[model samples]
Target: MATLARRALWPAVAAAASLIAAVLVAPAPAHAHGVALVPGSRTYLCYVDGLQANGQIIPSNPACAAAVAQGGQQPLYDWFGVLRPDAAGRTTGYIPDGEICGGGTTKYAAYNAARADWPTTHLTAGSTIQLHYSNWAAHPGTFHMYITKDGYDPTKPLAWSDLQSFWSVTDPPQSGGPGGFNYYYWDTTLPAGKTGRHILYIQWVRSDSQENFFSCSDVVFDGGHGEVTGVGGSQPSGSPSASRSASASPSVSPSASRSASASASPSSPAGGGSGCTATWALQPSQWAGHFQVNVTVKNNGSSTLNGWTVRWTYTGGQGFEGAPWNGTLTGQPPNVAVTNVDWNKVLGPNASTSFGFNATGTAPASAPALTCTSP
Candidate 1:
């Protein structure tokens, strides 16, 4: 009887141990809470995708709420929508979407469009328009607005000259607490008798105090006539004369800037050694001496970089002297300097940093080769 009892006791102990192991190994339920615009919700019918549970789109469900309450997850809040007006007689709606995580960090998303059912009668030539904007998110930030006259291309951006005007929130930037909201009004006059379709582009930036940044949204506008009414106040006078002369200006190019920022991470060569990569901005020949050359370095390898060296050859320029602590160029043009970037030296896998130097001499029309070494 004693031997039989011992055998039964051992079997029961083994079963209990297995159950505990299973409980420990099982994954917690997928936490999917974030600010999502319900399709067909009230006056808006848009979808907010790719929202982060703790970072951007806080989970509002009971399970997520419970988890957050238990200090296991981050809480999220929704952003309210508002209107923004620019120098040109155009209005746009700014909506705060939730947050998303990319490249191991959280980024905010904002919805941009024209106000729903804005009276067209108020839109006249030379009419100074005031945009009544608002913010209803937990995080505080300001919205920037841009207007494109020839309409916008999702794949191809319009030329800089085609942009009618732009506006941004003023100093002492806007902010909001939990369930807090703000309203702002911007004033701009419409161009005289310039009747046609126009596209409005709006972007938001989180304040330095906040950790979130705004993601761009698609543009929308209502192209009606100057006969509608019953929205805001009357239009202003003295519309500026419209000009149609096509002139190419030396403004900054969006494609070039985006390419510089986006090309920070390049795929490693099939058989290359372990290290990071860096790229320099394209400088035009005429403006070479007075220009600043910005370079972005990204770690493509799996290892962490404690220190790195960026080497490049210039035909008309001098060699690098040294760089600032954060890789900023602080010396005169034509001389090479090493930017001492201690903060940037410790780059993790797939991380990137940007630094630049002023160039005195003209840049060669063609781009020079750049090499990076890890220490």
Candidate 2:
């Protein structure tokens, strides 16, 4: 984990600024809003890994600090916002191979460096897993997920030829979750017999805008189930904190919301003046008469720490199937509820988090409008 400080967004989005002597016609960015993939994106995990009890960030992980040195601290400050505003669904050929991680941005080029020692999530080979994406800004979009081909080496620069997408979904199912996290959720089946470590890449291309968000999540197919062991969590070295630094940047604080309600009005964060917001995606399950859901919530509030609650109604008369993990759930059919578990309930201004669940429905019908509330 690289140490980092909490960043406050310049609300109302960002104005194009000239920096690094790079002359571009597009406006400079201010608030980065898009996603934080779970188990976690590189920027998101590194941000968490670098945090200290005192809310300071000086990267402790060797890779994270190296990334900062290469890319500068600004990209880490805007974790959710790595994008190509001009990419019109072009992949492989469109983005330069080495620059994929940064979306070809000079500021985030360090992340494109070929190296090991980055944080990783552990999983079983060929397991079907749920995926979550945060909503810093909500827009209708399609998601594309890919994995590196077998025998591909992480030590080498990433190329488009080295990856093959396994999943491409358009507006998957999602729930309006709490804790400042409105997420988009979908299930993916890992390729069979995949062993060792691999890179899980994600691309979120918005239909409303040309901008597209990307992510690189590290995973090891070690039959460990869904346990994520790296960065702020555990470690492949069996240690939480690897190398430590005396001086750290300001820590990025995560906030959470307590409970949400089924309401007509959307839950927009109180980002002083700007309307920080949250959004949801809900799709029908491929399984027999089931529904999968995701909610992507944003935290652009004045407060640092927060909690949340999520509520909804099954207009299709469907009900939940079982208990969900990482949070608590209640109610049935028409009126449903879920609250943030003790662990995940925090968001930083312009930051986001995510959660998910499933229900009994052949196909997802129009659910009642949702409302997320905060602490």
Candidate 3:
């Protein structure tokens, strides 16, 4: 009897050990997040160009190809996270020269190399246009947009002094999207007298943490309107004028100075005029630079809300940490949209489901605005 009991115990113990090993070996979830310039950041455009029918990436642009070949595809996988989270908002003394495009990180080192062959967006010089910054996730703080001075060389590494900031806004407005690709939109005058190829360097600094994001968008001041070349896409996506939700950018505020306290008008609600009603409350776990909100979405229609989406704007600059139930939470502060996940798409008449997110910013005194829709 004792021998038989020991045999059974051995098998049970072995099974338990295997289970523990499996649990311990499970892969960690992807936690990468960051911003991409919408004419598409270098990584973003290349990512768009490289996306395959099977969903794997294979770079078609020469620069992108070389970059991947040099750094492997992991950088592109976290295309938005090409940042040094500890930048402390420093421009030159901290980040070495030539590494400005990649924020002095090794993963994106290839992007820092000087090369005129990178993709370029065509725009008119001194054009007053709304700029869109794709938020893979939202973060509070400020956005400093600078353009390389005219007579700048694209074939060399970008230097801090080489940039001339045209506009800066703190806690601007935003629009949400699916897949963590929300965008922050604001309007400003593109540098005038700029001709030929120039680099648009962006720095996103978070207020609560040292985390910061960086991007280098290549542009040419030409007569063309919203035209992007060298990436091989038939049409450019993510341009301010592109037909994307929450694409409109507010004109530069009269002050246009680098002030974080300015107010941004709420984004135009998504989902048409309206169908459903939404309410928001910032959860209790909020602090100086961070907070979370629970948005309760109600189905007002007589029939089931087979699918639904909700859009809102938080006047404070806020960044979401990840997708909510597989739905994308995107947009800069003052604007956000949350769509449904496959599992939670159905809502019977008068039914409701709550979606929430933890964001990196201070909560506004009032809920910005909400527009809910279904189809």
Candidate 4:
């Protein structure tokens, strides 16, 4: 009996060792096939929104920030990892309703939130567009593109029943690689009559492995070519230019109440003066549903600036949390006016200073362009 038990234990140990070896030799788990880029998917575009020049992920889009606030930064960093290793090309009952965006996995669950404020790609209905699917970890696969059925409401959780197969491509021509401009490219005509907001659900069903990847690209059929909203500004229409990086540029025009951009010229000052410009930045915060705003006042004139004032309106229902620092705050929500205190009022030519305040609310999709004035 003891000999029999020893033999059984040896087999178990051998199997365990084999499994460990397989795990050790597998590709990095965080890296995966990739997500939609042309009409950027939620995770892909949010990753683009939050990525700073310093390699930090700080989302400026309210929807992106809310997703980050719920799931932290891993989902965005692993933006391409929204997959189910055991799915085996399964749909419907496999990935539950309401969690389709995240592939029914907790790692990317935040993206499953039902909201209309997500960064959006604009396209015309029935137009032929090139689909650029990333090849982060290239493998033989068939790409299935699905669109939400007509009259679909984006404010509700997504259900598989809402999607209808639109297009698919098998092993399309490949270009770029493991990083920038890398993707499996193909062109297909979009389904006709899709208007307003809808989710484009994509599945990369690998022919070689059971591993499958999913992406949710929020799009609108509003006659616009390929401009995006809620991510600082509109992305250039058409395929992403070679000069564009994985993270799209955030310096373009602002998206109404969702974000703000500096005007071409100094905004008309309260007293018709125009010697200063103000730019606002959202600072890192530890709490969810809250943000810190930092506004910098720069003097562009040749003479000394004896005093400065900055004013802006908030349209997203954000309210101040506490008294501001280094400045005096006045007015109320939807309308904010700030002026420098005694210690930091004066500035020489080309000099700058900043003031900050905390706010209680989800980050707005856009910030109001700030206008600075001097008396």
Estimate the Cα RMSD of every predicted model relative to the unseen true structure.
24.1, 15.9, 15.3, 18.1
Q: Write the per-residue lDDT of candidate 3 for residues 19-106, one digit (tens) a residue.
A: 5553333212145555544445677666544533233456666887888788876666566677787897988888899888888888
Alpha carbon deviation, residue 257, candidate 4 (Å): 19
Ranking by TM-score: 2, 4, 3, 1
TM-score of each model, in listed order: 0.27, 0.57, 0.56, 0.57
Worst 10 residues of 3 by lDDT: 250-259
lDDT of 1 by residue, 1-375 (tens): 012112334578876665455333322212221121100011011111111211222222232233234332221222222212221221221221111111011211112212222111213344444332333333345555555554434223333344554556543232222222122334444455444334333444445442322222222222211111111111111111211010000001100111122222222222212576766664221121333344666778888877666655556764322222124343333433344343345677976654444344554455456666676
Q: How do the residues 1-375 of candidate 2 rate in per-residue lDDT, one tens digit apiece?
A: 111111235332322221211222112234565554554667766664554323344565677888877766557656677888988677877889888877787777777878767766655678776676766556678988889899978889889888988888897765553223356667778788887778888889888878888888777776543334445323432222222111011011121111122112333232222323445455221234554444555566776546776666666667654434344575556787666544345556765544445456644444356666675
Please list the C-alpha lDDT of all candidates, in the order they appear: 0.32, 0.57, 0.59, 0.67
Candidate 2: C-alpha lDDT:
0.57
Q: How does residue 192 of candidate 1 score in lDDT?
A: 50
Q: What is the lDDT of candidate 3?
A: 0.59
Regarding lDDT, does 1 or 4 come out ahead? 4
lDDT of 4 by residue, 1-375 (tens): 011112334578776665455333321236566877666788877875665423346777788899988998767767778898988899999999999999999989999988887877766799876666777778888999999999989889999999999888998976544543356767779888878888898999999989999999888776644445666443322232311111121111011112224122222222214788777766433134455555667788899888888888877888765445445676677888888755457778986655556576876666676788888
Q: Higher-lDDT candidate among 2 and 3?
A: 3
Mark the 10 consecutive residues where model 1 has the least summed lDDT: 246-255
- lDDT of candidate 1? 0.32
Better of 1 and 3 by lDDT: 3
Please report the candidate that would top lDDT against the real structure.
Answer: 4
